[model samples]
Target: MRLLLVEDDPMIGEAVLELLRGERYAVDWVRDGDMADTALRSTAYDLVLLDLGLPRRDGLDVLRALRARRDRTPVLIATARDAVAQRVQGLDAGADDYVLKPYALDELLARIRALLRRAAGRAEPVYEHQGVSIDTVTREVRVHGQPVVLSAREWAVLEALLARPGRVLSRAQLEDKLYAWKDGISSNAVEVYIHGLRKKLGNELIQNVRGVGYLVPPA
Candidate 1:
């Protein structure tokens, strides 16, 4: 999935960027709050990693503005704001969860997973539709009770589609979920990955909607 990371610290931002990239997420990071606001205004993201202490605009204000616009994109507050009052304020401002600085990366990832799962209205960590099973935590995929290996891009496309079965996602929508601002995506990247997935899994899995886009129909 795609994410926006709003962090000003160079070291922290670099580390988190690498971590998220390693996890196969398309992440765009902006150092200042203004840049974060601008990015939020222009694009749609699956999640936002926000820091309260920010330049130009405070992270809280940025979040307030986002809520004012009625954007329900999940926001995870990761900052040094460790005080109880500050945490309450962030929750009140619309943050889905909070993680303190110097936090364990594993815990952060777990929190992110939980938020994403909740946003998708799923209580289980594993996503299953039509005998295709995906374990988000283990990064494992199984088709019809057997194991199946998928390349990173293929997995991204598959997960994006299977996140909500019966929903149609156009090419542009899939591209947005798979690419960040700096990532160079090929013209036929989605088709390539979809083809790869179809070859590995069954051809019946990911159906095209004639002139529309792709969909994972409900079982």
Candidate 2:
């Protein structure tokens, strides 16, 4: 998944960025609301982690602007603000969820997973089709009841294809999900990862549409 992290505190931003990246998410971090608003306008993200205290513009304004543009991307507000009114206002302004500043990283990850699950219209973390099964939480893949190992990039590609099952995801879309702003992606990076996934998972798992990119046929 690709995520936008809007945090002003260096310690918090650095920690969250590393954590999300380690979880195999493509994360773009901005330290202020202005930059966050620009990113929201320019790119498509799977989710957004936003902090209420920001520079240049208020975080609440950012959220309102995002909603004003009719962007339905999920937003999770993480801030030091703990007032009941603040939490209610954030929800009223269109945040999908909220977490306090000193929250557990494990719980934060859990909330992220839950939001992703809801966005995908799925309740289960394990995704299964035919003989292949993948546990999103465990990062485990099994084929025909046998464990299979996949590289991080390969796993990312497979997960992207599985995210919407029958819907085709263009190479550009997949690339967006696999890389952040600083990462250099090869011209054939998506192809390479897709090839790796096919070889390890199954030849017929990801279907190519010749000109339309790829998809996992509906089960």
Candidate 3:
């Protein structure tokens, strides 16, 4: 999934970015709230990891602006503020989840997964359609009970499709999800990954809607 990480602390930001990228998420990191706001407004992200204390503009204001524009992208607030009132305010400001600083990485990852699943309207960690299963927690894929290995790019495409089963996603949309802002993507990258996924999973798993794009049909 594509994510925007709004943080100013160098150590924390780098750590979080590395961890998320290790999980195969396309992440764009920004240090200031103004950049975060601009990125949130211009790009489509599956989730946002926002820090309340920011430069130029506060993260809460950025989130409020996002909601004001009817952009309901899920946001998880990560800040040093541990007070009950601060947590409540963050939620009231539209944060889907909150993680106080000095948190366990595992807990933060779990929260991120939860938020992503909730945003996709799924309550389960494992996504199963037909005979194929994807374990969001383990980042594993199985076809008919047999484990299948896929490249990082291929996995990104599959995750995007599975996130919204039966919903068509254009090539452009898939591309956006597969690449970070600074990453270079080839013109045929999405097609290549799609073809590779079909080979590893099965042709019938993902369907091309001709002019529309691709989707994983409900089983």
Candidate 4:
């Protein structure tokens, strides 16, 4: 999945970025609310980690603008605010979830997964289509009760497809999910990953819509 992380603290931002990357998410990070707002307006993200205290612009204002523009992308507020009123204010301002600073990494990761799953309309952690099963928490894929090994890129492609089963995603969309803002991607990278996934999972698992894009049909 692709994520935008808006944080001003160098230590915190670097730590969170590395953790998200290790979880196989392509992340673009900004240190302030202005850049965060610009990135949100210009790019597509599966989720956002927003901090309330920001330079130039307040994160709450950015959230308000995002919701005003009808951008329903799931947002998790990560800040030092711990009061009940502050938490309520964040949720009232349109954050889907909130995490206090000095939080456990595991708990933060779990909340991220929960929000992503909810946004995808998935009630369960494991996604099953046809005979293939994917454990989102473990990053494991299995076919016909047997485990299947996939490279990180292949996993990213599959995750994007499974996140919205039956919804066709164009190559560009898939590429955005696979790459961060600074990463260089080849023109045919998405196709290559699709081909590899088909080989490992099965050709029928991912279907192409002529000139449009690709999707995984509902099980």
Candidate 5:
């Protein structure tokens, strides 16, 4: 999953970024609300971990602006204000979930998972198709009841494919998900990862269209 963490505190921001990245999430963090707004408007993220106390625009204004633009990306508010009214205000302003500051990392991860599930219109983190199962929360995959170990990049490639089964995904699209905007991507990196997944999951699992990109055939 990809996340945009909007936080200004260096200590908290670095901690959250490292923790989430360790959990296999591609995270882009911004210290101010202007950068957050730009990222929200420019990128496609699975979720946003927004800190309510922000520099420049404040988190409430950020949430309000996001809703005003009709951007439906799920947001989990992270704030030091633990009052009931404050939580209500965040939710009312369009936050999908709330996590008070000084929170447990596990709880924050849980909220992120919950919000992502809600965004995907699912109630669970496990994704199943064609006898292959992907545990989004665990970052595990199984095929034909056997565990399949994949490199981080390979796993990322497969998850992107599974996210939209039967729909052809261009190499550029896959690259976008695998890397941040500033990261350099090899032209054949997608092919390399696709080849790796095909070898692991069976060649029939993913199909290559001559002119289009790749697709995971519907079960």
Candidate 6:
């Protein structure tokens, strides 16, 4: 899963990044609210970790802007202030959850998991599609009840395709979803991953629409 982390403090940002990456989450970290806004608007992220004290713009502004635009991506506010009024304000401003400073890494992770689960509208983290099953939270995949190992990029490609079954996802769209802006995309990277998936899963699972893109089941 992908998450956006908006934090200005280097130490805290690094700590959070390490923890989330350890859990197999692809996270994009930004130092200011403006960058956070840009990333949130451009990227399809599962959740966001927002810091109230941000540069360029206040965190509340970022939260309000996203909500005003009808972006339903879940956001968890991380702030040093733990006052009831502040918490209420953050929640009212569209934060899905709040984590106070000096919190345990475990607690932060738990909150992130909860927000993602709520955003996905499911308590279970597994996504089942016929003979294939994917644990979105754990980044684990199984084919026909057996484990199927996939590289990070392969898993990302699979995730994007599985997210919208039956829809013909263009190579550009898949590229946007699978890789971050900083990561350079190859010309036939999407095709390569698709071929790999077909070889592993089954040729009948994904279909090419001639000159267009690819389509998965829900057919």
| Candidate 5, superposed: residue stretches over 4 Å from native | none
Q: What C-alpha lDDT do the candidate models reach, one value each?
A: 0.94, 0.92, 0.93, 0.94, 0.86, 0.83
Mark the 10 consecutive residues where model 4 has the least summed lDDT. 157-166
Q: Write out the backbone clash pairs for model 3.
A: none
Query: Taking the tens digit of each residue's C-alpha lDDT, what string does model 5 give over 1-219?
Result: 578989999999999998988877778899998899999888988789999888888899988999999999899999899999999999999999888889999999988888777766678788888888899888889998899999877887787778768879888777766776556778799999999998999998889988789988877
Clash pairs for candidate 2: none
Best by lDDT: 4
Overall local distance difference test of candidate 2? 0.92
lDDT per residue as tens, model 4, 92-132: 99999999999999999999999999999987999888888
Superposed Cα deviation of residue 2, candidate 2 (Å): 0.6
In the range 29-55, model 3's lDDT, one tens digit per residue, is 999999998898789999999999999
TM-score of each: 0.98, 0.98, 0.98, 0.98, 0.93, 0.86
- Note the clash tally of each candidate: 0, 0, 0, 0, 0, 0
Q: What TM-score does structure 3 among the candidates reach?
A: 0.98
Q: Candidate 5 has what TM-score?
A: 0.93
- Please estimate how well model 1 matches the true structure, expressed as its whole-model Cα lDDT: 0.94
Per-residue lDDT tens digits of candidate 6, residues 1-219? Answer: 678889999999999988977776777899999999998888878789999999999999999999999999999999997899999999999989999998999889888877776764557777778688788666788999988888777787776666567778788777765655566778999999999998888888788988889887773
Model 4 scores a C-alpha lDDT of: 0.94
Residue 105 error for model 4, in Å?
0.3
TM-score computed on alpha carbons, candidate 2:
0.98
What is the per-residue lDDT of model 1 for residues 165-196, given as tens digits with 9 covering 90 to 100?
A: 89999999999999999989899999999999
